[model samples]
Target: MGKSLYSQIGSLQNDLNATVGSTENTQPSSKVNRVTRDAEVTKQQILDAAVIEFAKNGLFGARTDAIAKSAGVAPRMIYYYFQSKEGLYQAVLEQPASEFQQMLEQMNLEELPAIEALQVFLRTVIAYEISHRYQGMLLFQEANQNQGKYFQQTNWSQPLTYVTKILEKGMQEGTFCKQDPYMTTLTIAGICVFYANAYENLKHLTPDVELLSDEMIERYTQAAINLVLNGVLA
Candidate 1:
């Protein structure tokens, strides 16, 4: 028989604990060349582990030892490479911004009409969030933690700059209502991130909702597009 969801969560927690404890207790190996190679390996592993760690636990609750274990690295190696867990979280975030930007750049948005552009962008955003759940989870965690200052410093600029241009185009062409482009971007992003970030918590609240299913995803995408296109006015 399959385990209960609660038991599965408990199992995951317990496994993380064992992995963390093992890494924390092991002593670093002594070979210089081996240490260098190991350090590089550890750093990559840490980056991968950190996306899940920071996403699940946020910055304050996530443990360095847990991250190290998840990455299969010595506990201290995270500090040696990243200086702190916060630094590792920042590194994990860097890739998503560039990846999103490259994807956006490749699309010839200028060729599409305004409403078509909006729909296309929504589809792209939803696809990206769905496909890159880990990256989306990290973003969701950061946004949920509401570390406004940190996010403001790190990410607030680039995406806003790009999105603002698109929204401005939409507004000018009368596809969208005249609204603050920046705030609209936040609303659109919030719509995507909230469900993902809160999925674990939400599952408890709505146990019958099979959120990961293809039907639900299509339902969500359609609802999200409608909500954005037509404001909540009965």
Candidate 2:
């Protein structure tokens, strides 16, 4: 059974108590011997665990003790690498930005026809969004908690920039409606991510809805794809 929201926070705080009773002594490891692979592995593990905690609890509610337990590391090690829990949250925010940048690198968006490129981009975004749905909530938490200071700092514009380019190409090719590409990109993104970021509220609204089930995901993905294509395609 899942823990209640407040319970999750309480449990994590308890774990934090166990992991690092005193943070004053805990600091980033000063000892380094050429950035060993083992250390890198540890950082990755911590990152993975931190993502879960940050996503579930947000920055203020997330507890490093729980993250330490999940990552199978001493609390100090988190401090060693991330310097602090907030630092770890910032890194978590960066993970998706890094991923999107890497995904862009792997795609030959420029070679594809504008419509085809847009399709491919939507598919990729949906897949990425579904897999990391929690990050959207994490981002929402960022906005509500800090007025989006960290979000503004992150490189989240890579995909959007590509979408803008795709719109320009489609317009130039006379295949898509000539409209403001930037606003269109935002509209497309919102339409695609609506269900994902609204899970908490939505699940309650329709308690029977299997939001993450394979059937629902496929339905939502197709619906989003079709809607965007219809809107943009001339």
Q: Give all candidates' CA lDDT scores.
A: 0.66, 0.77
Number of clashes recorded per candidate: 0, 2
- Looking at model 2, which ten-residue stretch has the lowest summed lDDT? 1-10
Quote the positional error of residue 63 for candidate 1 in Å. 2.5
lDDT of predicted model 1: 0.66
Predicted model with the maximum lDDT: 2
Clash pairs of candidate 1? none
Worst 10 residues of 1 by lDDT: 1-10
The CA lDDT at 91 in model 1 is 73
TM-score of each: 0.67, 0.79
Candidate 1, 1-234: lDDT as tens digits:
112322333443334323222223345533454566555566767877888888788877888899888888888888888887777777777756655665566666667766766666666666556655776666657788865534654653665566667778877777777887778888887886666556667779878888866666667777887888785111
What TM-score, to 2 decimals, does candidate 1 have?
A: 0.67
Question: Candidate 1: which stretches are off by over 4 Å?
Answer: 1-42, 76-80, 132-146, 232-234
Report the number of backbone clashes for model 1. Answer: 0
TM-score between candidate 2 and the true structure: 0.79
Clashing pairs in 2: 16-65, 28-80
